[model samples]
Target: MRSAPLLLLLALTPPLLRAPEGNQTRIGPAWSDSRNPIVTTFSGKRLDLWSLRPLTKAPPKRSIDAFLGTTNARTTDKRSLARRLSFDLTGLPPTQSDLASFTTAAAYGDKLLGRRSYGEHQARLWLDVVRYSDSNGFDWDEFRPLAWRFRDYVVRSFNADKPYDRFITEQLAGDELVAGKPKTAADQDALLATSYLRLGPWDNSAGLFGEANRVRNALMNDLVETTGTAFLGLTMACARCHDHKTEPLAQKDFYRFRAFFEGVTFRDDLSLALASDQEPLKGLLVTDGDKPPATTHVLAGGDLNQPKEEVSFGFPTVLDPNPVALCKPVREKSTGRRLTLARWIVAKENPLTARVLVNRIWQQHFGEGLVATPGDFGYAGARPKNQALLDFLARYFRDSGWSVKKLHRLIVSSRAYQSTQSPRRLSAEQLRDAVLQTSGQLTERHGGPPIWPPLPDEVLKANPAFLDDNKEKTKSWYPSPPERLGVRSLYLVQKRTVAIPLMATFDLPDNAVSCSRRTTSTVAPQALTLLNNPFLTDASLVFAKRVEKSPEADKVAVAFVLALQRVPRLDERRLCEDLLKKHGIPALCRALFNLNEFVYLD
Candidate 1:
């Protein structure tokens, strides 16, 4: 039997060994050698890829404006600047009093950056990059109830002004940090931070042969891809199947990088003792399973079943040629691979991490980054139009104790950031929160579990998978109590299969992949949602009630200032008054909500 199979293999091999034709060389079998051909010598052009090169040092006192040569750029008026700063820092529109009392841009920027709302807003942006959701994604889409602990942790981290490098360490290796015994509330918070590993979509359903391995590989792949795009701004998933087509990343590099996470497994039974209240709450986190890690191999064509030559733990060879030494903890249940990886990521010698972070912050404030592609720093992505400015920002970020608030202050104080620019639409969360704040309906509670706001009957009916059917009486989707409906949009439950209708209309990103920059689309549904959605209608009614006691002329002025952050002109006030008399204050409120000035930031 062995001889017969060997003869068959020999007969099949000859076809691949055929004589060379023309200038083409003969090719070998598909799996002849599992190892990819390594190219150690990169050309000068390849070495000069902007993001991959070492960071260029700058003088200690150089300002952001000096690098951009934008010192002559004109600043916007105080009211517009106040509104912009409020939305940029806190994701909320300025109050009438806030606009009235606005002083210098720097002072106002510092004030907003210090608020609790700043953390909530920044957490939402960071959550988008990590694909954080409250449920498993695929067909089953089961809920992950304790996931909000991680969300709250992120909010607290930002508000406390935790160093960016420390933030990276906690999310990547928080469980390892408490490997011996957790003694403090900070240690417990570290455990919650490990939930970052479990944020991606998962499939709970069983499948065919080798399905377990397949699901595990899918998860590992998501972790590696998310880590790359979220921290390094590289499209590493492109190298999983073969050598990356456009960049220097290789197939082996992908598997070796993934090997760092081979020991990780989910742990949901852990309890965190809350600092606010001494009660213990169940938490979702990741831990290294109590066993030696399985050896990882380069999968032929990225298939779990076609595993090839085994690879060891290491960073991407393109980023650093040295190998990492893993320290196995004798007293703990971990390989310590993740901690090593995390340290390397935030190390001063690493080129991509700081640059990627500052670029994302710039994108949030300016509607686009200096490098237009926030997540891709590969050969295929856009090169920074202002490399000197980007380098200066990156160096300053790392040197200033990796402080995000300091970075925000530095950037906002620049003429480049404060200058007048074309108007940009509010993000989904900002628009929703602004509507609630304008109507005086926004709940000011900080955090706990996510809340389920009311969804349209059609939307609920469409997503049958969102309901739990295992119980005797099938549990259907139910909105939270009426009081909680007014909470900020960040607290809304983020089900993978069912998006809140209004948010979906305004382009809430699908939570299945890392989203560095959200796509802004102009469509009929956006207008229709604002005009016809019951949430907006109810908000308008509440807003009308707030201003109905005032005189008609005063009502128009108050409404305009509240919604648009500026006083209404004579022509606008006259038109609004006519609408107010004919259709009532609610009608005028509804019309204000639909205005370009109300929903857009200038």
Candidate 2:
């Protein structure tokens, strides 16, 4: 007689092989069968022609406006739209000429999306989703020098507009996808994307948690949480202790999902590192090599000592009722589990992957997702305010070859994106980068070891680990030497413990978990830091110098245009002129930089 497990597997296999139900596919609970939203496929595929028919019928803007209601139709002018597109796509304010030349919001958005800077901006947004940092976040905070390689890969991937499915696959199973040694740049890039696996804050050092297995388990949790939130957009880690309170996920589901990572190992292999000045450090990989892969067991109460029955590699059951049966690999390897999982995630039939990704892109553009909880899409999370609009955008994103820049153009051209009424505060990175650009100190040069901006003397004194043997000077932390000083804020050295104080004050998410959305708050420290931070003071001085050297006869007007992307109104001009008379160019410049118009996008 066949074993019980074999019988179960055989019984579960047929549903996965079944043809699409009517015109669309669905997974229950996560996605119900009755809700048939149009999905896209490639050329010659049955669904591809139908996908283009919608675009031929109506533009993305009209469709979006219709969904938002007639009262919300486009009214904002091109100038405001240009400014919005510039900041959203390139993370910088539009110049006077940039605003002047804009004929339509769509044209300017297209231009901005084509720039290399667009990818850099996209990379910064994705980094937050992946919990990326240059160093581990524990007390030690030892640097992950090679982490920059992965960061660079993300930027390049966006710039190239690599298909979203390929991006997900590479990040998950790039080690398995590449052949032999990774000798060429493309091969190396594939391996580099796997750095996503190693990115979450970890401390593998002995005695950090008193038990080696516990630390390993914690690392596994990080991997589970990152993968779930970043790709699947569900909080799978919530089920580690027990059944997920709101979702269909169970503790056994967590281990079964985790089994894909069992053979993965960390090595300091330079063969896969991107070419750079500094020596590349640890690499993430999977190799069972002669031995069978390790077994995974559900830890009762998430306690290691209380191990339960062993489990096999599988997808989450909510996505596929027979998770194990759904994982039939086309190209098998010794530890091909991850490759199978990666393929399943990008499969067109899976309801969550495209939806989650499109939501994140929406969140980055608009400051909040339609579903307010960007990372959590479970029953406990906030239901999407506009599910129809969300589904439409998700289908469009997939139909468009998962081109991020295309998504940006579609969203930015919408009446909602063009409107100035719903203003978003500049992110911590955007705020700093804007100051640098306004002061003419911003650097567009991308990709190198992370740079550290200047911190207060007291901060360096308090965090001696960042300082050289002579406590007076910083060792690995260097804010100057000119070239490094002007790099973008996203590229700033992210020592999780010693984050740039100004950024921390402005609410940089803690690097410990997958941050779905940044919290905006009104606080005294935020005000105090903006008022007194030396970086701002120095930028103010630079701003004054740049304005002083401008060819324009009206220096105050020049300063205002540089800072706020527009000439000051009569009242504003009078205030700046009075300050200029009393305190000089620096005072006028500082006041302009601090203006509400300068910090909040409208």
Candidate 3:
């Protein structure tokens, strides 16, 4: 059977293929400004065009199809519309197959949502919210060698349309809740479950207990901070040290937040140490862990060891203390602190949880959330364009019992999500690969361990050569080779000293901290990746070759539809013909592959 990501792809509507509406807030059909919202397409088979909507009522037509109406509809030029969708969803262009399908679909106005390729495109957005990473990034470089196990779990989660709440609970509390002493298949993904304890920027050069505390603290902090912004649209970090100086949080609340992970500790289960955190447990308890809390004190400036005053954690003022206020979780032998906090966070009445999550889903599809900052919802942050709508969404999230995939279906089913104005950011690596697969280029290698993809020279330098010293004969490097191609980004080892330049250039987080939103930079270095990088060049060659060999259309037309997602403009078509004449079809294809507009989502 096809996998979950594949399944989701099959369920989607391509970003480029849409039945237009009138007076549109969705940008693409109109192509309003150069700043028009990015409509994401996950290859042609899967697009998020039918996913998001701001209102339930009948909405406006796509700009391209709206004013053009029946009078000039067929005659009006659609060169720009096609190009936008191809780049946004597929991350590649229309191929001969795509052109024939989209051309017929657009003309006849049929329901274009049922192919396996479509849902895979939508899966791209799911990867980002989880902060999926291959290697452990912090002072410790490669301990998370096989953490791709977690990445695979994520891919499977989205592909299977795992209910969102179940997804969150499993990731956050899996190891603790799963049954068995050593973990079993019947144990509800225990090895897969330990990943819950594995999220965040962790380093342990300090000391085991202290380091465990640190990682635990860091995870808690990340849990609070990212969860807040990612799901609630609130800047909860400001409340950490003292209180949110601006947002509705208070100092006591931050401590109450810290109280959750009061008993978490990390032990590298593997001393064989092939750079993975694989320490065989002498009886390593993955969850419901029994540990001792040394002390609780107010760090004068946030230094854990340094204490100014004896302090106990409490709930934030912005948040009602009722969740855990009455029943204080304690630890004589075990700390129920985290369980208390998580229950509170996911509680049905918790106003911000569902709201923030829904906002993220909306943001994924629309390119902008009702409240723009996403993570930081404070007085100083961008005000919600539609507060009532955000509230409605949040309520829906809670009432739905935090069903993530169902939300996907709901949002995608909306006219807004389906609109051409899909404001896209990167759909994480899995999403990117899934789209590739739908386009018949994706490689779905299931779990074993993480594999490293090619990286720029600088990124390689920063990453420690993952080696086994005792064996002495040979040691395998995690990132493989710097020049390798066709490897997925998820397999690349993360380095604290340096990041994959292409990812960073495209605004990927460094993994040092929790990043809820990435800055979409249009800098020169990013351009260099598209223009000069070997990967892009190779991929372009692959894209070009795919188009050239495919029948059913002229080579130029096929390339434009497949690679660029739209037909070429008269001028652009002329330029291609000129490049072919001046140099050769190969040279012309190379030139077209290097265009700035081709790589970036508009």
What is each predicted model's overall lDDT from 0 to 1? 0.82, 0.72, 0.48
Highest TM-score: give the candidate number. Answer: 1
Give the backbone clash total of model 1. Answer: 0
Give model 2's TM-score versus the native structure. Answer: 0.86
Q: What's the TM-score of each model vs. the native?
A: 0.91, 0.86, 0.70
Predictions: Cα RMSD each: 9.7, 7.9, 14.2
Model 1: runs farther than 4 Å from truth? Answer: 1-45, 207-210, 274-277, 327-331, 466-468, 472-476, 550-553
Residue 60, candidate 1: Cα error in Å is 2.7
Worst 10 residues of 3 by lDDT: 37-46
Give the winner by lDDT: 1 or 2.
Answer: 1
Cα lDDT of candidate 1 equals 0.82
lDDT of 2 at 298: 94
Q: For model 2, what is the C-alpha lDDT against the true structure?
A: 0.72
lDDT tens digits, residue span 216-239, model 3: 556667766765555455666776
lDDT of 2 by residue, 1-602 (tens): 11124233223333443324673443421222212111111111112111111112235554666778734665576666666788888888887888778888888888887888888888888888888888776656777766788888999999888999999988888777776666567777777787887887777454555877776778777788788888877788778989776555667778888887777676554365445526653453433234666688998888878899998887664334343443433324546777788887777656577778888888877788888888887666777788777778877878889777788778877777776567888888889989999999997776877776677688878875665333433234666566568888878888777878888888898887778788987688877777778888888999999999999989988997788777778997888788888999998888777777778887
TM-score-superior candidate, 2 or 3: 2
Provide the clash count, candidate 2.
Answer: 0
Off by over 4 Å in 3: 1-132, 181-186, 190-194, 208-224, 267-285, 292-295, 308-314, 322-335, 413-442, 456-484, 551-553, 600-602
